[model samples]
Target: MKRFSALGAMLALAGAAPLAGAAPQPPSCARPEWPQEARRYELEGVTTLNFRMGPDGRAIEPTVARSSRWAMLDQAAIASLSTCVFPAETVQRVQGKLLPLQFVWKLQGPDRVPPALVEGSCAASERFDRYVPFDKGVSGDDGVLVRLLVRGDGTPYGVKAEAGGADPALAQAAVEYVQSCRFAYPKAGASPGSPVSGRVLLKQ
Candidate 1:
């Protein structure tokens, strides 16, 4: 596993103050109550993120003042905070004000096992069969999982090695191959600019 100890320390130090060019500070207030269901997540080694609420009550910008090495934990914190419903009354009070909200991702317990495959509309078709080659580094090993975000046009916008047991070269090759492959666009409704997430498992 990649060690994030140094990154974590840096985040802690930066978290102590606002960014250099940030807007003036707002009033202090406790975090709004989150749903009971949100407490079920395991967020150990996660970062505590600070968000600035816009006049529309939506998160304007997110900054990781504190982070744990685990990206999953940081993502979870952002996800949970995204669903938060800030006080409408308070929002009106600070119509032009930028409210600072802090979210500490506390791990509930042990991390749960991730699902087998998080499929999306796109997949490796026969034309691109050669691109989905086995990861030679793990010829006799169990396997590794690579998660990627594919754009509506079938172009890969982002790639990450979800599980890193496989060789770095293999993971890079898979990412490059996937980026080169194209997919059929959605026929029904309008294509979304947002990325569609999927997983590729390289096994022995």
Candidate 2:
């Protein structure tokens, strides 16, 4: 009873230096917002971003270090900072440091209506069958709900593991399979769908 689908991945040009990998420290608590259009259509995903701490201790040139496949989501994340206060002392310690964050889009509702890019639920390629190669014995569960961020053009921008949990191997496989997928929303039109929370039941 599971239906696995494919998603899209966008390639962005290298702009500024990549953000520092050092774990996030204190005072870096700026949360991103969900795009209005994306929320209307129920599109969700994670936009991993990076911004440079200019010499003046203010944020500058925030860019999409990693795309969520949804242009709207990415743009929303970049515009999150209006007053970035950087401590010159801290910047000195981390001379060439860039900030990195993963802005997420998760919906809260009881509706299971799948998000679409056009006028209806998205249409996916018939490639799910061959995506995951796991043994039924260790797959852990027969089914799991996968939350996805579907872009307006029908590309699944992001995929997430839902429920309390699932077999480690199975969950990893499911995510990888979905990430490598490609889909289309014939009538829904191009818009972001945050949580295309679809139930995926494994094949016997």
Best by TM-score: 2
TM-score versus the correct structure, for each prediction: 0.32, 0.42
User: Which residue runs of candidate 2 sit more than 4 Å off their true CA positions?
Assistant: 1-25, 28-31, 109-204
lDDT of 2 by residue, 6-64 (tens): 12222221342333322133334344555565664355566677766667666677777
Compared to the true structure, candidate 1 yields what TM-score?
A: 0.32
Q: What is the lDDT of residue 164 in candidate 1?
A: 41
- How much lDDT does candidate 2 score? 0.51
- In candidate 1, which residue pairs clash? 43-107
Candidate 1 backbone clash number: 1
lDDT of each: 0.42, 0.51
Cα lDDT tens digits, model 1, 1-204, are: 111221222122134233322424333333433333223221124356766666665555666555543456556556655655445554555445433434443433333222222234335543223332223222213333344444555555555543445566765655664565554444554343322223344432
